[model samples]
Target: MLAEAAKSQFSRDHSDHLALVRAYEGWKKAEEESAVYDYCWKNFLSIQSLRAIDSLRKEFFSLLKDTGLIDGNPSICNSEGNDANLTRAVICYGMYPGICSVVHNERSFSLKTMEDGQVLLYSNSENARETKIPYPWLVFNEKIKVNSVFLRDSTACSDSTLILFGGSISKGDTDGHLKMLGGYLEFFMKPDVAEIYQTLKKELDELIQNKLLNPKVDMQAHRELLSAIRLLVSEDGCDGRFVFGHQILRPLEISALSTKPSLFSRTESGPGGDNSKSQLQTILTRAGYTVPMYKTKQLKNNKFQTTVEFNETQIMGQPCSNKKSAEKDAAAEAIQWLKGGAKESHEQVNHMSKLLKKSKKDHL
Candidate 1:
């Protein structure tokens, strides 16, 4: 009804109507006095539309609190006092798994979802088409697929928001390395930072679970946890890399092996040194193994098994219910085989050498 009223009022004037709609829909200025709002107030056919918006905002807040979606009042101001980081953290809490990060390059700005593929930012977004984005991460409400995927009602966010409100946190392949969203994103940080992130994640999970079991839980405790989370996420001067899953899997150039021999060369220490995804890739490449490709086979129980193949030979097969887990299993098996092969060959060569030496002595 409000939309129809605004449309009818501005039907005759296209430019004013667009400006008014955008301002009304998008984030408003922090102050009570806004030139755009004033202009709309004077030109608008009725004051009821403005009143309706205010009422709607209040109702929305009420609903959020009642349903335990939020712990406290949300900041309306976009200024420094508004705590943008806190707002982002709260958004992450509610949005949880439906988050994305902005990827800006010379060519374009795209949003990469955790599990799903990349998506283009909605043209209506404030960050869209900007030469540079203010923040590296973004949390989106949802995605819609037309000709291509696009994020709707997206907001700029920071790494801290993800650490606090993102999905399951797991230890990465190496120390001081952590992965989120089932290895879709990787973070390299100090041991302390990793510990803090894990601790906060646990607290947030428990809080959310408790709230679900009983919405009438103490508001004081709820607010305190949110406060701690906000503080943790707001910390600065931390060093880490926010890497997309695809970027991690991107193959290294063949020429890079010569320049970075230490990274790609087979280790004398043994296979268990580092069987990480990248290391596995290096070992495979060195052994003349082609880039591993996967084929999915559906089973009778509606489950899937992923098979990793190299040069038409099946290196490993993984049976799991989900595609992601199955793929991980297959890759792990391939790495194990590559690592074990080296050890077996070393033993075989040593045994052959001993036999050759003994036979030479007998002949002499």
Candidate 2:
């Protein structure tokens, strides 16, 4: 359908083609996932309609050349695709009553109107705050880097982002375990969480370079950064799909920076409490990733209690208020609990205790 649209060259009787072009124009505006593919598609489809108009312009130019159509001495060089000149000619005719008015007034052409009526920038008040200078990241500005990770399966392939990292590279036994977890948690967690982290790192670099302190930047970079960060914190099905058998929500001890010390530790608050699973879920969601809660455990008295059940397991927690504090906790606990399990969780608990002690000593 796209190819056919791009090549057609006819001046008249293209009502059907025009209608399709218009329909696609409408579709382009309605869809949210309309990224590069959508833009390319709409352009390809619209090109066909332009070809039809180009055909008619050729005929019109032919009449003007060669001493003119009526008084055929020498027909003008009938040019096609001369939009600017053609538009000017048409407008000139309308302005001044002359013999050319007949040609310009013809129904075959109407200034090759744009598919979109008028370009609108920042239509709403909020949009004005959100809009940024239109510096598109074109191919000229883009640089691609190939990164890879060797999976324990002994099969090496090109992977843009590495999944397993740090000293605990996936060993044969761990790889098998992770594979099982992958199968179970594919829907609930993001399988490519490490990749997501790498992406977030890159996005953060970009944000640092172009976003953070730029006063002119109203909100575009903030939105993009928010999305990138969301993806960074989102649970990559590694745990949610019951991956690894009832994954741990918080990696044991959250960081010392936790303002309330209850963000993830307050089990009494319930899954939707101020420091509950819902709060953590919100932080991840805002950052750009979707996390579905499969289960919940109350954290009263700083200990997980009970086997909480839900009618549906797919619940998303609300955003947390103390993200920076949570971030500190996440970083501190990453190595402590992520690799090990109940033991590792306990180690993280101990580690936090030491961290507090060290801080107290520094103060003293």
Candidate 3:
């Protein structure tokens, strides 16, 4: 039926094509005695339909053989002879960026796309009314919004598919987490996953560049990369969620920095060290200011917490896993204080420091 439909100009309409494909898929999986099987057989038993079906079956088998996905004739190849994982991966390769996440404690799903927000499964989907969904992730063909968003031709996919085929990934706020789609989506996984993902991205990029440089070159290596991507997409167990990174919901904006001299310059040791306290102290000393002394408190959890009073009117607090880290955080806060109109000159800093010291002494 599919072959006949493909050859007939009348059956080449989009609706007819979609219906034929869906029916064929349903027929392949239907039981011989089932209503679905009967429906497909009755609808497609015409001489043209039968001829078309035969041609399609032959083409499908030839493709499987060419891809080395099958060793024998497809007509005799049973379901047991197929590699389900490889087949799903191949499907994912074409349906990438069509990934969706299941809603938490909800019956619906959400896609990470600009056009669609929440999507419902098509009534004909096997997962449409299932009580317990088999997979948390799904790869869908397309979404149409009528009264609400509807996912067409959806298929359940593993977590690996997202990692492999999803859009660009960037570091998340905390360690061992990654943000995707310019921070629209987030994933928490093993740190190794991040490392592996970076490596894979690099490899894929190089292959693309090579292909671009020599369009006619044998693409065996490129094909291998694609296969690797498919394999990665079949892995499981990476939790994901939709989130806005840095409180900026839209894409980030880039701007040139002001030409003004920075309050401090990074030294060889870097910003993560215990130098923040010393940096603050040096700035204060050079300004000839003695303000209220900064205070550091140790939390019950053993983490260091520090509070720095930038002026009589402004204060900043920071907490870190260790005393050194806490000091670094406080130092950064102090720089922002200066930049926010506290004082840029040494004389101004010294005056502020003196006022702070007197305030502390008076309180004592």
Candidate 4:
């Protein structure tokens, strides 16, 4: 499917929706329809699915024409359709709130959605075969659960695309911060940068609305805004990553924590007293990774089970009667592995502690 979508002999690094467009267009433009079966057989693609897609596409075009969304000449609508960055931005625009953070590692990467937490892409994806994607987020089509939850076809996207092309944005909990999806996704940038993105996004939305209303309207009038958008997405320095398990500490919350010295101490907190969850997150965070994620599921026996995940390690504790205790037990189980009960988690946290103490003494 990837090779077919890419239209390339060699495997490529692309997870964009336009690739799908280009592939389907290529199929339609093929001179010899006889080789269709051969192509499908060689590439492990299903001819039945392809035929359905072909039929659906024509119906879509007819519906659009009937609805006055487009005229017979698609040329006007496709003026910037080949612009890969803009196409991805458009996909993100239409697919708002379906975005997930892309955290790359040396050999592989992981995905985390706002609601689902840790996820994986199917092995067949071109993006899945690659160790890194040079973008901050992926606007996915959908997700499924087999052995584990997996994200289906997705497009790698930059921060600028999301910020300038996604849903309505709002101010965040702190200065120089912006948020979306009811504050599940947060962005921090210079205040001016935020303003620029918002300004450009507003103009972009208006231009689109105008074009939809008047298909033949001259879009060249907004060429400046178009140029700015093109420039931004192309040169985007993706200075962001997946911080999956982060939680903000409010002022009152901070004050309460400060009053309790042992709260930060593992020896004191130690997997009990609802502090296991906090301790698990703090240790992982101090180790320079995102906070650990906790997933809770209701069992058939009227019990709840929780799994705590971090650093690609997923540990599920014994089930409990309620969600809170299940999460706490899972966190405690993870803490056991992190804090030298098994290894790395505790050593790293202890290492961070030493660094903190050294810095404090040096200041004194």
Candidate 5:
């Protein structure tokens, strides 16, 4: 009803009515399109529309001042480059009614969402576009291409802490964060790492269909399968080292055959080690989720059995937090109490002491 009232109050004679409606529809569409891809192209349609609609919306809101529907003073929204970028990150990671931590990185930069409003920002330009000044409310940044990404809902946490770790700008980590908890976060155990395995199986089937491998041994088939995955998921964010979704590969070691194998050898060899997803699953397992690799079972052929484990500390990071805000609040409370002259006392002690003395005298 409130939305309807807001819509109804829009004026027909206003030159921007058409533009405002167009902008609203465009914003809605861009949001929907934005959710479709874990990673999007440099010039996707949604990016373009976001730029357009954002600019127009700012313009339309400005026009509101002349008409007096609102006070000449209009409410303003603040924007920070990092916050806007983090918002993009969350949407890329997705918020599918569950606890998730979204992670992303480039060749030299890495980042993750610690809190709810952080977004993923991308630019395909050789040098990323940088904006310094604040714009009119309608002004929107152009659609940018994402290099890499990860989005995950978190586990059921008693306390909301979006821990961040292992990202140093010098070592090339660009971490951002957000948190939601209790009633705000809904936990679901559906579509865990098992889905990733299923996806791999489908791709393997496709390779078989394309005559890329002999079914009996499948060495070449396996290689082809691995190559396909490397191509499809190798972008900065696509790799799972930071997100820790699943550990399908082994770490790179520099021995004669001790070197880390590519992602292909890792998944086919078994589900642990350098495989990033496997590590992620291990992290989830330690956190007490019933991940399948951690729930070991006998293999039918009996050639080999796999068990996955990771040191708790090796995981290195947790989600982000609102603790900064919480700290500020605590400090404020302390200050307020000090100003109000509140105090704690032991008044009951005086009466208890007198009673004790009388009782002692009677006993004597």
Candidate 6:
């Protein structure tokens, strides 16, 4: 929302959140009793909007004063939140689980979420058109699905921001391994490194809880803890990435599945051969889904098995003698499953089928 409001004042050179802070500071610096109109006009900002924001800011300060959360002066509170990195961390903290992973490849980058595997940011986001985002994560305020899933009002999040404030961190099975969002976000460190983070997090959590309980408590009293937290948040940089969902078949499992030759055919060539894969891809693409991807792996018996993935669905094919046959078999199975086979209901496909049928009938 503040994107356009801040752009003229702060230029699109920093994270979206920092732009707002810069714009507000610049506006305040330029504002005087009689010069507010000229300043807003010159910067292309709305004068009424600035007035409303000032009104709301004063109201919050008054409310905080009444609750004993702040003294008469507001500058003291500024000592903590005024730092840009801390401000970003606080935003990430409030927007926990509302995060996306930034994946960059040769040509472009994409965003992914836990629920919907692949997503995109709305065009308004500063990061939407970026080909390479330095950070591994983005904290977003909202998401909606129209033509496709879109994240809105997102700010790039550093490894430190998400690790320190994003979600509950859990100890993994191995030492120095940490997991967040039920293992979706993984943090790897030396054994001693994990201990340090856990300790700092505990102290920070305690300090926040104490401040919540005792409004009169001075947060500055824990200067050492805050300093350490700030140092980590700044210096650690974005050294990690969120875990994206994909599966590698275990060797033993693949061996067991490969042994069942009696129940399966060696290839999908009898009726559905090479053309099946293309047919499946066409159908899915026309239905507004990604073209299916085939993952082929060689087995111990020198045979290949393939898994075709699309729309977050995965279907494994019978083991075949070659990569080509394995992929064909995989696509055949996916096609059969989508046409309403034993794998269960294909609600999305079925819904699209009905719409297509209706359109044909109307034309007739």
Q: In model 5, which range of ten residues has the least summed lDDT?
A: 159-168
lDDT of 3 by residue, 205-295 (tens): 5765665665544555477676677566544432332111111011111111122234543231222233656656544432223433466
Ranking by TM-score: 6, 4, 1, 3, 5, 2
TM-score of predicted structure 3: 0.43
Cα lDDT tens digits, model 5, 1-364, are 4543333332121112232444355455656787423212322234555567679867876675444333344333222222322332222223223223222111122122323233333332111221311110011122223453322111111110111110111111111211123212111112443334345545654654554333234344477656544333322232222222222223222132212221122122112333434433433332223432221233344322222323211111111134332222222222122112232112222221222222211110
Question: lDDT (0-100) at residue 299 of candidate 3?
Answer: 86
Per-residue lDDT tens digits of candidate 6, residues 144-214? 89989998878887776787787778897667767788866666566798888888887888888887789
TM-score of 5: 0.19
Candidate 3: regions farther than 4 A off = 1-39, 42-81, 106-114, 204-235, 238-364
In model 6, the runs with Cα more than 4 Å from the true position are: 1-14, 239-364
Q: How accurate is candidate 4 locally (lDDT)?
A: 0.65
The whole-model C-alpha lDDT of candidate 3 against the native structure comes to 0.50
Candidate 4 on 172-265: residue-level lDDT in tens? 6544567788766666566787788778888888888888888776777888998999899878765452122222111223233223222123
Which structure is stronger by TM-score: 4 or 6? 6
For all predicted structures, in order, the TM-scores are: 0.49, 0.17, 0.43, 0.61, 0.19, 0.62
Question: Which model, 4 or 6, shows the larger lDDT?
Answer: 6
Of candidate 1, the 10-residue stretch with the lowest lDDT total is: 355-364
- Among these predictions, the greatest TM-score belongs to 6
Best by lDDT: 6
The Cα error of candidate 3 at residue 291, in Å, is: 48
Q: Each model's C-alpha lDDT?
A: 0.54, 0.28, 0.50, 0.65, 0.28, 0.66
Q: Per-residue CA lDDT of candidate 2, range 1-364, in tens?
A: 4554442321121112233334443444534464635554644545455446557655765654432232333233223223322222222223221100000111111110012111121111111122221110000101122342111101010011112110112211221222212221111123365444445555555555453344244444477665544342232232222122123334222223222222234332221233434533432332223443233243444432221112121222222344433332332222222224344334444433322222211110
Which of the two candidates, 2 or 6, achieves a greater TM-score against the reference? 6
Candidate that beats the other on TM-score, 5 or 6, i.e. the better one: 6
Q: Go through the candidates in order and give the clash count of each.
A: 0, 21, 17, 1, 49, 0
